[model samples]
Target: MPLCFQELVTPLLIDGAVSPLSPQSPLSASFTSVLPYHKDSGILSEAEAKKAQKALADGNLLEVVFAAIETLRRVPSTRVNIAVTGDSGNGMSTFINALRGIGHEEEASAPTGVVRTTQTRASYSFSCFPDVVLWDLPGMGATSQSLEDYIVEMQFSQYDLFIIIASEQFSMNHVMLAKAIEEMGKKFYIVWTKLDMDLSTRMLTEGQLMKNIRENILENLQKTRVRKPPIFLISSLEPSWHDFPKLRDTLKEDLSDIRYHGPLQNLFHAYKEIINDKVTYLQEKIATNSFQNTPGMRDIDDLAECLKTYRLSFGVNDESLQQLARSMGKESSEYKAIMKSQDLQAVITRGWKLKCLTCRVMKMFLILLSYIPSLDALIAPYIRQEKHNRMLEGVAEDTMTVLKKVLKDFTSS
Candidate 1:
């Protein structure tokens, strides 16, 4: 008969009892060989695991888990804002439309014309990219506003990236804008528009004209100390020509890197914060309990029991580990091998051996401390608390080991 899920995991969970489920009860021989790499692949390190354990011992798990969940929920909604700004009649709207892979006539396209059509900051979404918005900002120096005031009013700090558009030679206004963006430690691209017009009107070869334009732009930027900002020469009417294709590809790549890494970084930070909070709570609990004179308060049985409880709480139990393995389409034994903790049931069954040893050591220490008079009461509670903390640390480390294994399996699969 085929084994039920509970039956499959039961032997693995049982203390000191070998399962007949397979030749290797908890894990296959092959999985044991690769277990070391699983430890290293997780987002948290052994040091971080120790910190987390301390936090859990000192703090509340429920609050940390809630904060982590809330932070993760916000990740999907995180928006990458890109701003396109330049002088009026510089094809900012047309460039935006082209960048979004939509024609100017399309209902969703930014309004395009010879005059200043984008009066205010109008946002458009990229169909191919989710949670990314492109803002077609009103032209700089369009009215009596100073360049600095224009930047402030437009809220230049809001955008993650900036695309500055120009049709002709890079003007003094363009240089100032580039300098301002550079001073603020922001990234911007210089796009020389109307390449098609220049190619048709100029007698010079396309290569020569492009070379001259690029050199001229670079020289002007150098004057304002704007070093090596990405400059692209392209025609809005013919995006296929010049650097338009490269520009599009580069933007996508940049956005992809930001989108992928941003959330992971934020989540990593949130995990640290949660762990810290947990540690604080655990510390307070330990201190308060240490001060109590009652025999129940000094007992270490509850501390020993926490190891098994923590393993189950972190989904490191045989059943949870097996479920994770099944989700990844791997054998249950393969997942079990990566776990750092002993089987929960096995630990419970054989726990009395360790408990006996611990009790003997504590009794011997107390007898010796009793002769020290004033120091006995002062130091005994702290010693007991330290032992409990060490057990908690071990449990926390095992929890992290199992978590890392699950994360590695999911990402690789």
Candidate 2:
């Protein structure tokens, strides 16, 4: 509210940097476009986008963004889990072996057989997804298990994706499984096994047979909520042929979604929400004189301490930045060199106070104006509240700027 603070903030209180941001704002445009909904940001599909949105809704906004920022540094070690499920003798285990590029009967390969080889659930790991685990769940028995029970027993929620193995026909059970998985709002793939057999059968041409199989699956799923899911027809024995390579390619694409894309999408949404929430809270305080209850912020000069508080909360303090630099094997100057948040660190100084003191005309006028009785009661506190609100906005903007730089460095690295 001090006349000198005009240098740091706008004159109008409404001209805050952190307003309830609209999508069209410059700040919003600098980040991901998938906040309220998904836009093809080269990462999130409709399904992954929904999962990210759910994660945002269920989590602390700032925490979600910060965690995602941290994840950028740990992507190599991040894990993604996949579940392979099917009816007994339907080649779920064979598909797992093929998908992992491990031949049946090879070391560490999933056991395969005509009977239920995977009686209890078995997990497989490959160097392809370092920390990844693929669980070959016990088969959904032929008319023996209920859908509800199958869902619970498999613990479907733990896996990021489900591969439902089908063969010979897309049976009622297969359609039901698809419906249930789709209903649960899970991402899945329909992998039709033994396409080699279908091709060798003398009934139809290979293309015609494949088309017929796809149509049959689609026709049976018409009444179900399972939309056009990624369906792959492959021979589990011939990993190099059919949809096996394409399936692996899809995994490559989606695994990135699992780690970075969807979470990054949520990060943007939450980041905006955090900015809006901070702005709204501070603005409400300005409206109610509630910041008068704030301890130690006795005057605008005490803003040094206030800025310190903001720095600490946003992890943009000198110490925190230096620590982060050390963690990244870089100099603190590297991050500080580009950070506007550094404004808070040296914001309050003797030179700054001297400059304010030089504005004697405004001070003298304030002095004369102080004698205006009831206006005197209003003037000082109003300025003080205005200063606090602007300081809050400045700190919030700097924090977001720091996050942006961190994200930039992360992506470039």
Candidate 3:
């Protein structure tokens, strides 16, 4: 039987556009105008009506509802939903709070000390674009349900990345999670959190502990029969400023070029870019406000400082980028090529940009020499030239080292 154009087009049109309007609104007259086109296209069919009725009975309308919601979330106004899960006290909440630059251990928003925390999946979001949403899922190993049923109920694979966090040793649950991820072909990371605790613990030597944990993690993977796994250790309290940067770099290296064409680095990138533009605008505002009354200027200055701090919350900074570049070297660019098919020019451009930025920041330290500041202007220029040359050389050396290390790691792993 031929389909009913009237019924099909009615639902799609309502879902796509008219649903957002009030039902009582006169604009519904426009919906009436389409009936003639529907009649011309075959106004109705018994099969289409039956399927529609079944969909309603099954409460399948949410497919369209969620389609609308997803479109909304992708807009700059709505929050991007990111789910983070792990064992208790593994710094999952801390990481999310820190991602927003909020003090995770503070009174209200503290990451720890809360009893019965995050029993079910709950969302926390900020007002910013690619607005941030951090969902804390219930800890695993507590529930006795089968893994397949649990995953089906929670829709676990919908997340961008499944963060598997642990402190001392990886558990069977971690192995199970990894196996499930492998079977389902999902992206995941082994985040070895609480490095600082291990470092400070009197019971175990830090080096041995780290080694044993890595081995256990590998053993766990073998037990699950996973072929390749990448693991990282993180200290939420003063995370190796360098280590977290490397993780961020890794995330960038792993995403495909298609992912980059839009806002990259999760939804946070959208928020980050929006905040950057806002910060730039506010800075200009402050400059203007400074020329106004003194009290007004002070208030503007305070607001500006607050916004600047928020701008820094997402872990975007020149220092971190520079350190990551130095540690990663040219391998960073090579990884970009492999993941995104980025050209050599793009790689070199980033290398030179980081190299220049590092030198620029370091030049600030040269002011301390101003006390003796005895270096003549000529000598200063010569020193600058020497520094620039060294910077370029360092970038080149580091790039090669990182490239070799990444290739070796990839092949060996």
TM-score of 1: 0.50
Encode model 1's per-residue lDDT on 1-413: one tens digit a residue. 21111111111111213221212211112222322221331344555444333333322232223333333334454588888988888889998887777787878889988767888888998775657889998987567789888888899998888899988768888888889988887778999989999999999999999999999988988986787888899988877779987888677656644553554554444444443343344445566773243233344445544554444433355665555454445676775665445543434243454354356676798889989979987987776666555544444555455444443332222
lDDT value for model 2: 0.63
The per-residue C-alpha lDDT of model 3 at residue 307 equals: 22
TM-score: which is higher, 1 or 2? 2
Residue 266 of model 2, lDDT score: 50
lDDT of 3 at 2: 13
TM-score of 2: 0.53
Model 1, position 23: C-alpha lDDT score: 21
> lDDT tens string, model 2, 1-413?
10110111111222123222111222222222333554542333455444434333332223333445544544454577889887787889888877777678788888877666777788888654666789999878844668898888888878888898999878787888888888877788999989998888758988888888888888888867469889888998787788877887777666655655555555555555545554565467556765444543344446566655555544466766665555444677876766554654434232344235325675686688788978877776666565555555665666666556555445433
Worst 10 residues of 2 by lDDT: 1-10
Best by TM-score: 2
**CA lDDT scores, all candidates in order:** 0.61, 0.63, 0.44
lDDT of 3 by residue, 155-207 (tens): 77666556677766677777887888778766777877777777777577766
Candidate 3: Cα lDDT at 96: 56
> Model 2, residue 221: what's the lDDT?
80
